[model samples]
Target: MLAPAQSAADSRSSVEQLVSRMSLEEKVGQLFVMRVYGHSATAPDKADVDANLREIGVRNAAELIRRYHVGGIIYFAWAHNTGNPQRITGLSRGIQRAGLAQPTPVPLLISTDQEHGAVARVGRPATLMPGAMALGAGGSRTDACEAARIAGEELAAMGINQNYAPVADVNVNPANPVIGVRSFGADPCAVAGLVVAQVKGYQSAGIAATVKHFPGHGDTESDSHHALPTIRHTREQWDELDAPPFRAAVAAGVDSIMTAHIVVPSLDPSEDPATLSRPIVTGVLREQLGYEGVVVTDALDMAGVRQKYGDDRVPVLALKAGCDQLLNPPNLDLAWSAVLTAVRSGELTEQRLDQSVMRILRLKAKLGLLRDPLAARREVLGTVGAEAHLLTADRIAGRTTTLLLNEGGLLPISRRSHPRVLVTGADPASPSGTTGPPTAALARAFAELGFKATALPTGIAPTAANVEEAVTAAAGMDVVVVATYNIAADGPQRILVSRMAATGVPVITVAIRNPYDIAQLSGFGIAASLAAYGWTDVELRAAVRVMAGRTEPVGRLPVPVPHAEDPARMLYPIGFGAMYRRSGV
Candidate 1:
């Protein structure tokens, strides 16, 4: 065991001592993760913001620290003015110092879902790397770890101790709404391996990673954000299909486990969601799986929990059921009211709260955010330089690139002969950014490769529906390059692929999402299909090089495709990404 740092030992004891002496009101502070709208505190939008912002105000940090003594604060991005780390530092420090500043103050825990890619809130919506499905397409144990490390370091610098990310939900159902892009893959073992590496990566950077959506939300076709997704799978199915990643993450020593809001009918006959299920959270997670760390609930504000349980009763049920931290509880007043009532009336034993707080506090101390806020802030913010993005972005693009369909040696269109290229899809601009990536870069890299690439502004490809026009265009073109782009909606360019296939041109279809697109567009019978997973600039250039025979198309398909028509093909046929290493496995 590593020698405990001075901060670790004292900070742990300090937190316990402080919790032990706290009165009912003081301990209540530990239960509330208050959301303060930064906009609510600022300008013209203050009226709307103030209505949502909940804070015990008096701008004085020292005074606020002593007053409510909340365990943590959620940072809502101020759209009018995106906050810089420099600006957030003072506010975060003041909130954090409250625990440390007290004579026996306990260090408060700070958490955020800084899965800061295109899907992130605080940063600009840069071209996000394809989510978990994309990662699965490009199988790299290192990629999972590195991506998480980048996320963790950035969060740690922001004075945020926890990342509610590296989503543990296995994306088994292709139609799974909210979690499709968020989950790693369909295979539990693959998801488990990626999750383990990811957790180690983030923790190595001193950021606590949360493996989430417990009891899994992968099989349902419906979304739980608006309504609870009820899965009919038996307990054995959940263990065989859904539990592996969570178990692997737990075995790998993840700091926190987040419960899903979806109802598991097979696990509980009453149909309570995992967040409020005693059998799942306490029995399975704690007793069966032996998870001893923190168990956080998915946002209580979600309709799954809120609509069914009602606002007043959720906190009581959750605390009793074994959830350690309650996320984004709607109507904080109701939550506190319920918890306080339970505590004062002897409904909840103080031992339960102590158990949760101790685990949380131990995590804070381990991350060192509890010890010296200044040093942690400086260390992270300073290291995230431009060069870091430049290098990692390349590796991410290269490794995550997947080769789904390759029919003939049609790629490597010899530049020396000036192959006539008809480029149909992909964002034409390079995904460039100071701190984030833009989606456009994926296409621009081809133009840089000396490929005579033309981008259609209408976002349609040369297909059979417009056969005469497409055939006329293809008559002189040496290669018909048809590309597919993933949108906010499902199944990219179904009609376009049909049209392209009818033209009878040797079309090269590139699947920019996961290979699951094969089920949608594979019937087109395009000679070659590539799953770049995403159109990052690095992957685009690499794809061009491999096509030209300048580089061998060594990248294998990470997920298998049983056949274009098979429903099971959606999970993935193989776990191969680009940069295929011949000798390793």
Candidate 2:
């Protein structure tokens, strides 16, 4: 055990020494990154205690650290764990204080899903950087690095040491439900380059960068959160499509790699998900890829990893499969007890536990968390959303406006030619449940650019009443701008767009989430079409700049858009973009 008065710096060089002194329970605890509910370290009220009890069977984060001796804690905005910088920084400091006060006295890794564009856990006061697809469309490795660095600085300021970001998945499947905009792009090489840039960017800012969903999660139509999805890539196909970015990430010296929950039969024929498959996680990621860094599993609470194993068996199987960190297990108590039993029973050797604990400790030391885990509240207040960081975010968002079609030079709509403008569409919440009023935000952007713009809130699937109301509102408008969020082939938003276009008023279609929706508007007589790839204020303003002729469309289609009538035919190729002068003559 560590001496009673020993500081972390005193034993930083001797990780082996610290590990040698740890108890069996402490070693096991160091391998799991559990989730805790509420913003405070200790339970502030019965409500906070009740929420924690419901989620992890713990009373609060302090008890979670003191009792379980957890090595890490992940924050979620929806769990009341984030409000702003002060709250997050204070929570991080409190968690660290609790962790340092423990018998073993090792620092805890504070992590969050601050993936920036669509999946940011920390909201507005922080710089809302562009998403992976946006960066891919921008096609600037420098911007990718700078964006990651800026976001990383903000996260580190808030005392978040680990970030689950720069999703290295190559999004080849257009109909992919989960990873559409989160991935860099469909081209494996391009994705690899951007992944490397982001890895360098994030680590440069003193945050441990994690490249996620190893073996790839991009080609699946099914979401792993609800069910298991199998990627049917052959060994050759896997080497081509799913392996390059992970290879590049490994080469980039990434701090950690998160395993996918999907089963790839080419790698491991056993019907087991990658998180629990020894052949895939151990053989491919460790032996084949030669990755010596920490291997963390995706959330254990998800349905994909829990199909065959019970809650208790899941963590043990993941560790046995060679994962160093078991994240967000459904039943923490059960999982911890099961791992302790496995170690004592020789199903898993203490030596095996030591290997993982050593890796975790090394990562903590590399991130400087071992020396000073607590963040300064005053520094956090000034660094969360610095002016320069927000400017970089705006500049990056400006580079991602991809114009797919502008027939008859319909874009760059002059305020003198078409003075009245109406903006309406589905302002859907992101998959991570971050809500922003994108429709109103877009109108404000347009108005700020000197146009009379009105925003209408038509839900994702516009009802008959919504369509009629929008049409009535569009009667006197000079041009109608509708933002579509991942419109399906048979979605009602198509009807909404077609009806607005039929009114003899020029209509511009902006696919705010995916470029695939632009393919569905072929016969709809839309005057212009472009993809923002996201619906945040930054993206909307970028699109507005392109439409207002203030900026040219420099972003090309990062992923191919299939023909609406035939999936085999391409509507727009991967590098297709229309400049103001390049539109149809």
Candidate 3:
């Protein structure tokens, strides 16, 4: 004997009530989001996109409205060049116009990974911020939040809504192949505190904020994009390490969550991926934690989801598990058809579909998607690369400067008269090309600062031969600046370590990538080792500024540098670097 259904007023407050107004076909349509990268400047392929028109049955932006109502569109690799933006804007207008073509207007949730710095979208005169670790090391929640807000404003200017940002994972594993600089810091509290600030920053400016890699992908030695990772933490460990930041982000009212592919036996069976796991997404995140927002899956195209499973089973499994949106594959046909099949077969219930559609609609409404839709859409896209945004990038970029070691009190490189300083590390020329990896803006900045920069080609493999060549090259330089681009690779870059140690002369190691790259270098005889945490133009200039004594080195090392250990199995053994300011510096 169940109670009667809620009164009309009570029903109006519910997601089901709002979603029930949509047609069954439109309800199904809301489950799919489509996007294309780097192909939207000229004809049908550029903005209206080939897949959106012919492949997915969306002929133009108007179809997005008149026909199947889409949940959203994800944008990646939009060109900053003026030649392309006009057409891109036209495409966005088409997407908005098409979305409005429906009997009842539906706001398309536009999303992108504008984490700012290395994780940026909508090209510019190039305002690059430092990586998250650089911001964390720089130590200002205010600046981090402002950076995110600025990123949101810029994203909005480009008609982007959801910014998949403020990566909440606290990086605990130095061996992490991908989520190194993206994470806030290793300490969960620190990550939570800063991310909450970023979430507010995004929301304050009217953009929906996304908190990501739920259940923590920070410590995994493997990248989920290539292979599924198995987390070995206990339930208690989850409370300590993984949940805090997410909890904070949720509390801050983030509109969406991006689930990771990592599996944990302690939490669920090894057979289930987190994105499609009820125990994780629905049971844990939704029921127990009470997160009412949309749960977004990491790109379904990745090997972790695509390779491990033989079928396209993830789509239905994830929807049933409580996730609301499936991102990237751009394979809307397969995913949409799969969802339809599941619905028809009763594998995916109408109840579940209603719930997902309702959340999507409510979020869209909340973001002002439905009301005067195109104008709101236009408002957001209008914010891209405004004067204020470019300025803030420089501010955060400047603040991230950290001076790790300056011996003989020789920094702010006193305006010495034509003292030829030889900067040697990754040589831009060579078959293999610089051990420092490919970063052109960085090379240009280093050169402009007047160091006769010579890059030595070195692979990520840490070998003795590479070290000898580097040492021999640097023997005659007045000052040697080694750009150590620490990679979070499966293997070691040991040659980099030996070369740094090979020198007794003033060898200042400037880590251009992961600060964790410095862990092995202490064994090499380096005069001073600094963690630049990133290799963007912002980072390069910040490093130069610190060397030139423009800004005080306020950044504390965010990750523990590795000490002597088996290169095969990395061990972050060194005491994380502290504020070591020289008297004159």
Candidate 4:
């Protein structure tokens, strides 16, 4: 313990020394966390690189780091689309190599939105664990910890040191379009428990954990990606529901906290979102909550901030609002210039800029990035998506396979009788509205379970004609399993499933993305209901095992499934799950 304490002191000293040497431009640069496509090799030709950079409104990766002295780089779908672990590892290493070549080298914090499940940026190459809501349904902090650890290890191996995950949002609103399955649950205390566990697990594995969308993004009905949403909770209500998990995360020593783009009139009357509100980001999160760690803003390029503040002004405003890092500014050059201008014009003090840069440097030192920024190719090959990691993912998925409703004991479909099944829902190959496992994968899982499963290719959005065709096809099947994606956004799917339920076939509605879908379509004459919470192949297989009686449905609902008609009334409350009992047992 004494040794560790001494090491921490040494790291702090090193960070302070480094900050003392950085120029004003370099210090300002450290506040910006820009985006980059994959490795330089992945860039087509010189012409393509120029064209792509122009299109995305950013400069070259190495040039940005060397010239701007950027603190970090976040990987998006374009960066890791190849789904090759080795290739991704190479890309990460290449970026670090470029950063190291700078005159005053600082290890770049290679980060990604590795939220797992549907929101994973690096898909096949990494272990695709279930999302936070599924892990919450597992009802085991041990499982959440293990899942986060495995994910962290994989990311650390790939030279990525920061994980923006363990969404602490208490998803209370059924109609919340963006944060349904990403959140742990509706209950704040339970979400707090899981958030602390995940933060510890990620940190223990050497990857910094960032509890995201602070002040809670779960209660709002709008998607910040498209528009700003407001949380109309009173101060007392916010303290009770939205603030607990974030408070718990801060207490757990979470390395970073991400600001949401939602507005809360109680915190700040200004129309500015929390990402640009000093009263919320600085006053509430830092001063009131006592969070001394780094505070990062969600993507500055998001429409929530962009539409209101314009690209040039948002970054400067965010920094002044107490955000230490600006993520994915639409135009890096413009954002950087604005920050420089603000500091020069006395709008943002140099001391404030140094304070943030110091925090960032300290975090980098803590992660040992300053010591060895590059990852070894051998370690990347040996650890990423290893068998053990995949197994851990499978275990979490299995544990969280919830049986929400089985009105007539319709589940555990009799394999002995060889039931012919019809698996129709969102197409997994090209999931209709959201990301998850494909419908084809669920059908395949049924086939693997010794059932003659026929899959319909009715895409995610089923037309009225598509529903008629599915109902006509369901007539021949003994049972119908309809997997629903985001029903809040995809209303047509719910309508199609309702029509299928009316066809007199034993309809099993499996919520493949958000569990709240069950609540939306509950009044329909569905025989059974299940919540997979995600559409990952592992999760789909686990749900199939539960249906086939091979694996028990042990998962409880993490968040309350509200009634479609009355949002206040819960159709299936949290902690609800039905266990399968064999007849003789």
* Candidate No. with top lDDT: 2
Residue 96 shift from truth in candidate 4, angstroms: 1.1
TM-score of each: 0.82, 0.96, 0.85, 0.94
lDDT of 1 by residue, 340-447 (tens): 888788888888778877777677667765456546544535644345654675556555555555565444456565455666654433222322122234335555
How close to the true structure is residue 559 of candidate 2, measured as C-alpha lDDT? 95
Model 1 worst lDDT window (10 residues): 430-439
Candidate 3 residue lDDT tens string, 1-585:
011354434433644554757777778778766564323322354544544555555544454445556677776663221124444455565667667666655668877776754565554532345668888877788988888777666556556778788798888877788898888778888788889988988887778998999878888988998999888889999889989999988887899999998887777875578987889998889887789998889988787877655435778887988889877654566777788889889998888898888788777766666554556443433455556776777778777766666555556563352134444454222111112343344445556766555556454453567667767776765556666665433334545545555565566777776776555555456666667776655676777666656666777766555444555443443234435455775
- Model 2: lDDT of residue 575: 87
Expressed as tens digits, the lDDT of each residue in 1-585 for candidate 2 is 233355566655478888987899999999889888788898546787898888777799999988899999999976778876888788888999998999888899888887776777887778888788988999999999999998898888888989998899999999899999999899999999999999999999989999989889999999999999999999999999989999999998999999989999999999799999999889999999999999999999999999988888999999999999989988888999999999999999999999999899988877766666764523876787899887888899989989988889888987888888999888787534233567787788888888899999898999999999999999999999999988878899999999999999999989888789988888999999999988777778899989998888999888999998898998889988988885456
How many clashes in candidate 2?
0
TM accuracy, model 2: 0.96
TM-score of 4: 0.94
| Candidate 4: clashing pairs of residues | 428-438, 428-439, 437-535
Which candidate achieves the best TM-score against the true structure?
A: 2
For model 4, what is the alpha-carbon lDDT of residue 472? 90
What is the lDDT, from 0 to 100, of the residue 443 in candidate 3?
43
- Per-candidate Cα lDDT values, in order, are 0.64, 0.88, 0.67, 0.82
Which parts of model 2 have CA positions greater than 4 angstroms off?
Answer: 1-13, 43-45, 375-378, 430-435, 582-585
